[model samples]
Target: MNQSLNRIAAMTARYYYILRSSWLRLLEIVYWPAMQMMVWGFLYTYLYQSRSAMADTAGLLLGAVLLWDVLFRGQLGFTFTFLEEIWSRNLANLMMSPLKPAELAASLMLMSLIRLLIGTIPVTLLTLLLFGFNIYALGPGLLVFFLNLVLTGWAIGLVVAGLVIRQGLGAESLAYSIMIVLLPLCCVYYPVEALPLWLHPVAWSLTPTYVFEGMRAMLIHGVFRTDLMIACLALNAVYLGIGFTTFVLLLQSARHKGGLLTMGE
Candidate 1:
């Protein structure tokens, strides 16, 4: 027990140090959020100008986008940090350390939380303050919603990392492809009802759909519907489990294929 506790402490402290590195500059933290905010802000203004009645609807959509940015950015932080280490060949040092793979993974996930806090949290807070949306109105439901978002994002990161492990940089094209597919389906700037019925199941299966819905529920209605919150929590757990399992399998495959040690020579 003592050994496990000490290891976690060390990993967490290392994560803190890594987060403070120049690579994680304030600009890097804010860049994605700013881009998302600008694009969505323009769209909202345009929609409001076209139809003044859509202002509240636009607010709901904009809030979802803001929250999604934080979740996506947090997961990306973990995956990219690990990938950069691998590209620079520094991962070899980590692999040879007394630390375990799970510990290293934990550290990366912890870094995700830190990045999310530094990057995503600010944007979320700003959206609430500017749009007069109260995320905390649902209190515990808000917490559950955020947790679901984090887990789902982590799962996506794991799957992306697995592909990177198998195909190296060549697999990176999938990132854009994923974004293209997800943006319309994730209910980022619109409600799921706006999507055709045939696509609703597909969208809801993506986890982010439920997350956005739950967020909208909490923010717009200020009431936690037991069913929605429970569903979101379940989806998060399922995806998080899949992500961790896939990450482990890919890590093993990489080890067997010598991918773990094959850095830029």
Candidate 2:
């Protein structure tokens, strides 16, 4: 048990050392999320002023944006940390260490949480100050919703990381772009029903779809859809399981093929 903890700790420290050494990386954690919030927050404000149908737009849109970032930042946090090792040529060193795949994943999950907090907290507070919107108003279920989205992001990140591990940097671009493909399917800015009937099943398959739907329901109708929340949680668990298994298999495959050593070259 202690050995596993140490492995996880060592992996976490490796990334922490990198983050501490670079001011730009630290600044980047906060910059992009804040910038995105500012742009969308203003657009949401404009819609509120211009559209009677959007009278209560601030809470709904801001909440959706913030929640969406939970997923985005979570995935970026995990993949970027993994990619950083690749960029610094540290992947080989780490792979050669006593660390196990599960331990490395545990470390990445912790790093993702840290990055998610660093990236989202400032923007969340800014929204409260500038727009007088508190997403927490969605109530206790907010925590569950946030976890569901973050887990979903982690699942996707793990898949991307696995692909990169097995296929090398050729697959690295998926780390940044996977979420974009997932965004529309997630129903972030709109309801699932707004999508074509054919895509409804696809949207529903992605857990965040239910999460955002639940968020809109809470904001617009003062209704908390526990069923959606439950579904999201269950789906997240399944996806997370699949993601972790895939990552471990790919890492092992890479080790067998000497892909880890080649990655640093």
Candidate 3:
């Protein structure tokens, strides 16, 4: 166990070194946030200015934007960083070591989590600073919501990483494509009330919506909304189970086919 911890520490330091490269740091601190702000900021403006105004427009949009971006950051960091090892032809060198695949996966996931937090902290503070957003009213429930979202993000990351291992870059694109469909259906910028009644149940089943609602309920209204919190927790578990299972299956298959070692070559 001590040996495994050392390996993870080394890998994490390597990733941090890569992250500190001036170009990547600039992209993370400036380019990505600006692009996201432009797109989601526009939507936020529309939501507030129009008569068909969104429910808790500022909070809903901000929460949605933050949550979705964190999810993207975590999943992409895990997938692309692992893929980078392959692109650089260094994966085999690492594979030759005593490190197990599960340990490698865990270490890569830790890097993703770190990246997500770095990106998220800045954007979250910016949202509050620039948009007058406030979640403090949510009190301790805020922590619960944050944990739920993070777990959901990690679950998504595993599936994304697994698919990239199995199908290469095309699978990477497909993994992201799922987000395009999910963001709308998740009711990030809008509420389930805005969706067709037929879609309400489906939207509620999605974990993000529950987190969003729970945030609004706790912070905006000072209500517990235990049902929403419970729902988010349950859905998070389901996603975690599905994602981890799929990841293990695909990873084992990839190992058998040498897909893990040969991808990006």
Candidate 4:
């Protein structure tokens, strides 16, 4: 019994030594969970405005939930597909294949679309049947909004996959844990104005913020918010470029460093 106890203690100490040497890992120890804590714990503080100002808009909250799920599911779909390859220890085999990164990315994206449809279609219908709310009633703007959110998800997922390839499995959990940080920043359940005055700028910097704000505008005013749509597109372009660049560079780095060969070890 004492021998087993010593082994457990030694193993714990070994990782603590690793954590001591790695600042990013240490930061992640706090930043990862703290971001989620901040996301959910304080996300509701912004909802006071919805209750007070959007009280009469029947579909505002419901619409936000549906759109939020679109973004969430889209990201998971993209990231998990990539993570699964890593888990299965197939990344080296993938890299050795003739497939290009962009092609791989496209395949992941198509998978994301399929996953999003699989997860969302039934829920949307259930919302219609149970709550008498057809998410489709939001109309053509909803399609644009959905597209932008998915683009943002793809961009984030690509960056995440890149980081894992470059940094190894230390970041493996990020695929699941990272996106919720946007729950607060994207103002999913509330308007941007609901955020603290300082957070307004931070929230606006993200494309999904525009999508959610546009969603609110559509629900409340019956306007499509073409201006927000334009802004969302512009930001999505920047994020997608960054994500693509990051992935390609990190992939090259991993390959050069033999990270791919030893990945998942």
Q: What lDDT score belongs to each candidate, Candidate 1 first?
A: 0.71, 0.87, 0.72, 0.77
Error of 2 at 134 (Å): 1.2
User: For residues 50-75, could you state the per-residue lDDT of candidate 1 as single tens digits?
Assistant: 75777667767676776677567756
TM-score of each candidate?
Answer: 0.84, 0.95, 0.83, 0.78
RMSD each, Å: 2.9, 1.4, 3.0, 13.1
Clashes of each: 0, 0, 0, 0
Model 4 lDDT per residue over 44-141, tens place: 33553356653455467667767877887788778877776787788888678665687678767876786677667766775566556677988888
Clashes of 2: 0
Task: Specify the poorest-scoring 10-residue window by lDDT in model 1.
Answer: 127-136
lDDT of 3 at 178: 60
lDDT of 3 at 120: 68
The residue-level lDDT of candidate 4 at 233 comes to: 97
> Model 3 over residues 92-197: C-alpha lDDT tens digits?
6787798776777778878877776676667766665665564454568777777787777777777877777777667767555666677878776666798999
Prediction 2 TM-score vs. true: 0.95
**If ranked by TM-score, best first, what sequence of candidates would result?**
2, 1, 3, 4
Best by lDDT: 2
Cα deviation of 38 in candidate 4 (Å)? 24
Better of 2 and 4 by lDDT: 2
- Candidate with maximal TM-score: 2
